[model samples]
Target: MMWGSSEEYKAMFVEETNFYNRIILGWFLPPMMWENLPHFFQTWLRNYIGGVFLYLVSGFLWCFVIYYWKRNLYIPKDCIPTRKAMLMQICVAMKAMPWYTLLPTFSEYVIESGGTRCFPRINDIGVPAYVGYLLIYLLIVEFGIYWAHRELHDIKPLYKYLHSIHHIYNKQNTLSPFAGLAFHPLDGILQAIPHFFALFVVPIHFTTHIALIFLEALWTANIHDCIHGKIWPIMGAGYHTIHHTTYRHNYGHYTLLMDWMFGTLRDPTVDNDEPKKVC
Candidate 1:
């Protein structure tokens, strides 16, 4: 009968779906390599390999803009922290490497769980699934990081040891962007822990993960250089500069939601006139 034949086809489709899920984790790595490798040869090749490559390319652009053009690239060397703060920033960035290493494994987990939907083949899942996955993943990740950043300041010893290096450059610049990565190893883990939840609970796309890392790094630089101790236009460096000026306010790391919701938003112009301090 026609009805009997249709039922058999449905059963076969379900079997194929389950079988494919088992191999989903394998797809994340190859794509990650393609997106992450080029920068290795530039800034990080000498020491950190990939990292040096990225930094060199980015730093070159940064230096040229500030040095030759005099365009007021947010970070002026004079604003960077001195002695101890600079040392702290360097050490902290080194410590954070272990967590950064875990990203690929986490990405695999997200895909398997249907926590993300930004993969190339995801279009096969239809537009509804793709859009839903993207929205949820972005919200969860942003919220998690915002809270984690806020907590870093609440704890005293940890703030001094791990997070302070970022503040060392009260005036943003190229060097200041990398300062946070030099946090203590523990700080690195703590900072990255939020991603674990997203990896485990969401179905994220491979491209989204790469995009997040790239955006995060670029954001760190932007907030330091572009905002340069001022607040403005919502998403730019101006907003982050307020955080540097008054550590207690502006707790949101990459978004305005947390600061607004948690009552930590600051108006930099109010009390931003003080002489800059070394982190």
Candidate 2:
């Protein structure tokens, strides 16, 4: 058995996420409120409520450190987003937060219900094989996300209805870490679908998968901050800033390899001579 028995392993997701759930369950909510709701809704709420604090805490802390204490060092003159823009970013993200979280919550339910290929322990596959599977899983996710993100632009209605919400902060003057997740609800979830897609095809560790989903919150905050890390392979804020500006190049997510492969890559070091394509 994965844990002592099927029953024990099945409860693992709840056990892992419950500390955050207790914030809702222990204080403003009673057990009765949760017991009465559908299981899917309950899990989604746990993720959504916990995610609100996670997004705000990490986003604000990054803002305080990079946008506030060291403003001149990170942001250029006139590039600092106005307070109104910051509030708009936060509001857009808050509105989409629930749907952004729902996919992973559903993935966890599928895994716990014995519907995915995910294993609960590294030892189940041994250290060597665990590392191999992890590398493969990461690559699949990177490849899948690049295409998912790019297609969101290439497709007409998808770009017009969903992706355009995020493109609002297309300039450095308008972009901030808060703009990281200021995507339309469906738009964000569609980009994140690759994470769930990896589960059925790869031997990902169950807990590790969930942790990575949460980590993306912090990461999106990084890439949208507009301060390039200048590391090759990794698609930093500089390249992402160009993506917002031109809407035609640098559609890769996480890595530049896909952009390089598909001929959409642009170097921020060079003046953007590429035509700004419109839908």
Candidate 3:
């Protein structure tokens, strides 16, 4: 068989990639919960389980910080999402999560076979080139995501069939940290397509790529909270909240660079006129 075409290599990759998942699963699942499973199922299982872990942890952590530890800090008492709304968000996110993990699993398959322009070690390209490649990779993802998001709103059919599920939480009363991943499964995957696509266009570090993809779960949670982080250039929650309301602005992820370039950027100050208590 060709390289990475054997069951052994696939098993190896799944176990290696599940480093974090295995740690958590060790406590909950039986000693050999993963042993009898096929490699394909193991990969999907670890991904889905890891995603659920991240979702609950990040979503609740943000809720605690904003609504409990520091009540009325970023949003008013009346502005917080109701329990039912948050529950709907959680339900939608969990439903979409299984499908959302598929892309990363496919990405693992590609990386396992050396199918993309990925380098496992910084020594492969030196520190300077590694940093440069990282920047380039980010740019590709940013630009791709900007358009992918904008097109989702601009294209009537796409918005109606795929993206409107996310827009359901447009108002502050409905939006929350949990609403970040509260998307149609296809919608979430479509938006994340850029992160994977960048691997083909740039020499991305394999570990860095995987980390960024997972970090997105937390980042999205942060941006849906309606808190203006004031991290200029970065698209903070204030910007994203307005995007939800306006439906025609702030169509970039991670940064405002693309939104500014496309003239779709709107200042978050209008809605964030309240006290600026950012963390």
Candidate 4:
């Protein structure tokens, strides 16, 4: 009923499933090669290979934009990290990749439990419903990550033991695409909980959920890249770059809505005039 007749839905699901499998697997392997792979190998490769490929691609693209374009050259040169520091940040990010991989499994468990629904086919739900669910998911995730992020700073024990590792890049330049994921594993997990929780709280199509994951990576990189500018209420690189320098404000991940509501929002343009040391 949520879609259509059982038979029609199943047929649509099968067609969409094949389409995704082809597109994903084809990214790394030629279609001719992937089509001939054993069933088990195909399944395993798609599961383990697909997400990581997308993550790496997304990170690389953002980093390229920042580095090649010198996107925020206007920022004081001293705030940028040295070449060695940038390398170290990338290494730390590599260390955290395994934790990122585990996140999807958590979402999968939620989906299997009937607590969440993810339609695999676009046709299964109309475009309007798909867009509506995506908006709701974004709102839920923004609210959740905002509080989780703020608590990571506000709570003394959490800050000292876990969140402080991320605060190391308390200035600009030292941040890179990888720096976005270079958190203490606990810190990364805590922030990611909202993303998983969104799946349970709303009906998100599988494709939309994948897009969210990619967006998370890209946005994280953009924020750390320290390009000063606001995208309306959504805090951009400028907002988060200031957060790194000041360490007490601009905690929202995607938007300033929660920060504005809670009075934690700090305008980057005003605050940048007098950057403070991380206390």
Give the alpha-carbon lDDT of every model: 0.52, 0.81, 0.83, 0.70
Query: Which candidate should be chosen as best, given TM-score against the real structure?
Result: 3
Better of 2 and 3 by TM-score: 3
| Residue 44, model 2, lDDT | 79
lDDT of 1 by residue, 87-141 (tens): 4554555455544544534444334344443243455456787678767776786
Error of 3 at 2 (Å): 16
Model 3 per-residue lDDT at 201: 82
Candidate 4 clashes between residue pairs 3 or more apart in a chain or in different chains? 80-173, 81-173, 81-174
**Global Cα RMSD, each model:** 9.0, 3.7, 3.9, 4.1
lDDT of 2 by residue, 28-50 (tens): 56788785776677777877776
TM-score of each: 0.64, 0.88, 0.89, 0.79
Candidate 2 residue spans exceeding 4 A from truth: 1-39, 271-279
**1 against 2, candidate with superior lDDT:** 2
Q: CA shift at 111, candidate 1, in angstroms?
A: 5.3
Q: Pick by lDDT: which candidate is best?
A: 3
Q: How big is the RMSD of model 4? A: 4.1
TM-score (C-alpha) between model 3 and the true structure: 0.89
Candidate 3 deviation (Cα RMSD): 3.9
User: Clash number for model 3?
Assistant: 0
In candidate 2 the C-alpha lDDT for residue 93 amounts to: 98
Model 3, residue 154: distance off in Å is: 1.2
Measured on C-alpha atoms, candidate 2 has an lDDT of 0.81
